[model samples]
Target: MSVLPLIFTSGWASGINAYAVVLLFGVFGATGLTDEVPEALQRPDVLIAAGVLFLCEAVADKIPYVDSLWDSVHTVIRPVAGAVVGALLAGQSGSVPELAAGAVGGSTALVSHLVKAGTRMAINTSPEPFSNVIMSTTEDLGVAGIITFAIFHPVGAAVVAGTLLVLGTVTALFLVSRIRAFLRRRAQRRAERRAGQAVGPPV
Candidate 1:
């Protein structure tokens, strides 16, 4: 079995939550659930760092606008994490070239990240904050479930991940109009605030 499938699955998961993927890989490797995980990822320091970051993300991801800000920050981090993880997996398995795996992982992660960020932007347009929390929880659960499944059945998990990536992309596209409306409303609000600020305080 090629490690590419697992790499693809991890990349997809990483876009949503890189820290969780790292933490899960470390735990699984340390516990001997999977030997495919590299020793570097299993180190205690790595696990701790990943754990802390995951917790931070868990909290920040539930907030309405905060999650979008978090996603913007991770725009670079997620793809880089995906590439590194893919290279490590490929190096361990010796089944795929490191560069090839890295390219696949990084590209997939970038696409998935864009989809997630766009969807979150659309969700943020909602007046209620519950949507953000619900979406965040769903993404977290989905990543965990898919990653765990990938450990046991890489190909199947890859298929599932790919399907999700496609669906997410489609959904984001469908929500383009809403996103535009949100942007316009936000801009109008900002302009209004600016105009109010420019006006001198009431005499």
Candidate 2:
């Protein structure tokens, strides 16, 4: 039951459309992004922080090197978030069991982060803006679903997560394959276009 809550809550917290935001939060500090979004951006700090992070994500996602940079940073992030949240919760109840729970929580976050990074890498390989948008949207939906499950039914969330973790792995492989094919096709098309232009369209 406890494990379920951790999984579900973490899952939901991993947003799809808000992946960059969530990831940034994970990279920077978990609390800022883990809690609910602020009701108003009236506060200067909140507004500025949000803007900077979002912009960084926007620019980073587009630049190949920067995308790698984001991945490198986030590699340490997700696990920390999981660990922090777990530790906080464990503090509430001082018990050996609780300590174990915290470890589990932190580990879960790490696993989630790895899966997410894999997906982003696959998605970013394509130069098509639409593909990134679509994948991002899909990720947001997955995160939302996990959150909803945590709130409503934890048992269900665990089952779903276990299933998805397996599926996510498969999906990662599939995405990698598709992205490679797409890149290859794009390169061929670009070469053809350049060749045609050089020949003056064969008159």
Give a tens-digit lDDT track for model 1, residues 1-203: 79999999999999999999999999999999999999999999999999999999999999999999999999999999999999999999999999999998898999999999999988887899999999999999999999999999999999999999999999998897777887899999999999999996898
Tell me the whole-model lDDT of each prediction, alpha carbons only. 0.95, 0.55
For model 2, how does the per-residue alpha-carbon lDDT over 1-203 read when each residue is reduced to its tens digit? 24435433553243222343334334333345333222232245654665577666555655544555676686666565555544544443343264565566666666666666777787666666666555545655666566554545657776776677677778877887888898899999999999988889554
Question: Model 2 scores what on Cα lDDT?
Answer: 0.55
lDDT accuracy of residue 49 in candidate 1: 98
Clashing residue pairs for model 2: 12-147, 16-139, 16-140, 17-140
C-alpha lDDT of residue 141 in model 2: 61
* Per-candidate total of colliding backbone pairs: 0, 4
What TM-score would every model get versus the actual structure? 0.90, 0.57
* Candidate 1 wrongly placed segments (more than 4 Å): 181-203
